[model samples]
Target: MTNSTRSGKRDRLAGAAVRVLHEQGVEKTTLADIARAADVPVGNVYYYFKTKDQLIEAAIAAHGHHLESVIATLERLPTPQERLKALVHSWVEQRDLAAKYGCPTGTLASELDKRDDGLDRAIAKVMGELLGWMERQFAAMGREDARELAVALMAAYQGISLLTNTFRDPALMEMEGHRLERWIDSLA
Candidate 1:
């Protein structure tokens, strides 16, 4: 295969791994599962990722890229407050999936934390980037306790996500999203 085709396959494999990891959790997901999801031959998965850890790392990178894309989309808004609200709204939009599978990053991080595979720090870095972005938004809004506010806001979402997933209730996320929007407005 040409280099371009090889790269395309690798990307597809990474994307598929991300989806499978999100759906099945790291311990339960396998290389064959990711290959099937990517529609590549099972053995071909080894061509791109030598081991499961490599595939998991690729999935984490894919999630980071996805997060950056979402941040770029939010950046198009007029103000930091509006951008923050848009972020909350985007989570509401994923209520159903959240209820079914939990927050993608949160769930993955929680599962990875149980293992001694050294993936915890890498996953934490990805989550930290998100918290840092949220903190910057609050700082832009002139909040004296920007970091605290950011932690509170993120904690609220994480709490709601856990409850929503546990109860199988998307409405909980929707309610929390509205509450978060109002809270953001209150900050301004």
Candidate 2:
């Protein structure tokens, strides 16, 4: 196969890895599950990623790229407050999925954090990138304690996500999204 075709398959595998990992949790997700999700044969998964850790690494990279793209879009907003509100709104749009399966990154990171294999560190990098972006936004809003504001923003998001998932209530995300928007505006 051509290199592009090979990459297409690899990308598909990685995307499926993220979805499967999100839906089923990393520990319970098998190569077969990813293959089934990707609509490819099990051997095809090994051709791209030899082990579960490799797949997890690919998922982390995929999440990182996706997060960067999102931040890029958010950066286009007129102000830091608007950007931060847009971020919360976008996540709130995924309320149904969060209700069913939880915030994809947060859930995966929480689960992987308990392991000794260092995959946790890989996922943590994605979270760090997000934290850095939020910190910059807070700084743009003229907050001297940008890091603390970033942590607070993330805490509210993560806390609401947990409650939304735990209660299986999408409305909770809506309410918190509004509250977060107001909080961000107040800070601005």
Candidate 3:
């Protein structure tokens, strides 16, 4: 196949993997499910990812890149406060998904933390990247306890995600999102 086609196929597979992995727990998602979601044959999955673990690695990388892009866009806003609020807003917009499946990174990390294959470290690093980004934004706002503030903010988010999913209520996420935005403003 041409390089462009090959790359497109792999990207599709990775994208599908991320979505499937988020919607279904990692324990339940199979290469066949990803192949179906990507509209590729199950046999062809081996061409790009030799094993399920390899595909999950690619998916996690894709998820990280997507997070970075979102953070970059938030950075374009004028102030640190606005950037942080925008980040919350972006997440709040996914309330329905959050209610259905919980925070993508949080759920994935929670599940993978049980494995002994070291994927727990990979997911932890992804979570750390998020916390680190939040910490930087808080630091820019002149917070002395930037890391603490970052952890607090993320704790609120993950907590609400679990509550929302457990209750099957998007309204819980929306309410908590507003509260988190207000809390960020208070910090400012």
Candidate 4:
């Protein structure tokens, strides 16, 4: 097969891994399941990912990249504060999506030390980039404690998101988001 075909097959497997992880949770998903879902042979799946952890790493990386793209597009709005609010609002609107699929990074991070070292590092790298981006934006707005504030805000956002997902209640999400927004505004 051509390189393009091979690459497409690999991507399809990775996407399937994401779906499996979302549907079955990381614990229940297996290489055979992913192969079946991708319609690829199990050995072929192994060709792309030496281990199940590698596949999970790819899925998490894909999710992180998708998130970064979404945030990057929204971050280009008028002012730093506007961009920040828009970021938070955009994330809140997508709470339903996470409710359906689970938070990929949070799922991995919660099991952080249990994950393969490489996978853990990759997830941490993505998170550091995101938090660092938030810090830079906040600092530009004259918030000297931007790093601490960014960490706090993201912690609140993630924590609230997990809570809302657990309860399956939009009201909880809205309450948490509104409180976070007010706190951010006070900081500004």
lDDT of 2 by residue, 1-188 (tens): 99998999889989999999999999999999999998889988889999999989999899998999999999888998888899999999999999999999999999999888998888888999999999999999899999999999999999999999999999999999999998998897
The Cα error of candidate 2 at residue 81, in Å, is: 1.1
Q: Report, for every candidate in turn, its global Cα lDDT versus the true structure.
A: 0.94, 0.92, 0.92, 0.78
How are the candidates ranked when ordered by lDDT, highest leading? 1, 2, 3, 4
**Residues 1-188, model 1: lDDT tens digits:** 99999999999999998889989999999999999999999999889999999999998999899999999998899899999999999999999999999999899999999999999889899989999999999999999899999999889998999999999999999999999999999999
Please write out the lDDT profile of model 4 over residues 1-188, one tens digit for every residue.
89999999888888888778776777888999999999999988877899988898778777787778977796778777777777787767867766665455666666654755666677778778878888987897899899998999788878876877787775666777778778777877
Candidate 3 lDDT tens digits, 1-188 = 99999999999999999899999988899999999999999999999999889988988888888998998898799998999889889888999999899999889889888888888798788889989999999999999999999999999999999999999999998999899999999998
Candidate 1 ranges with C-alpha deviation above 4 Å: none
lDDT of 2 at 100: 92
**Cα error, candidate 4, residue 84 (Å):** 1.3
Query: Model 2, residue 156: displacement in angstroms?
Result: 0.6
Q: Give per-residue lDDT, candidate 4, residue 33.
A: 96
Residue 12 of model 2 has an lDDT of: 91
Q: What is the TM-score of each candidate against the true structure?
A: 0.98, 0.98, 0.98, 0.86
In terms of TM-score, which candidate is stronger, 2 or 4? 2
Question: Cα lDDT of model 2 overall?
Answer: 0.92
RMSD, one per candidate, in order? 0.8, 0.7, 0.8, 2.2
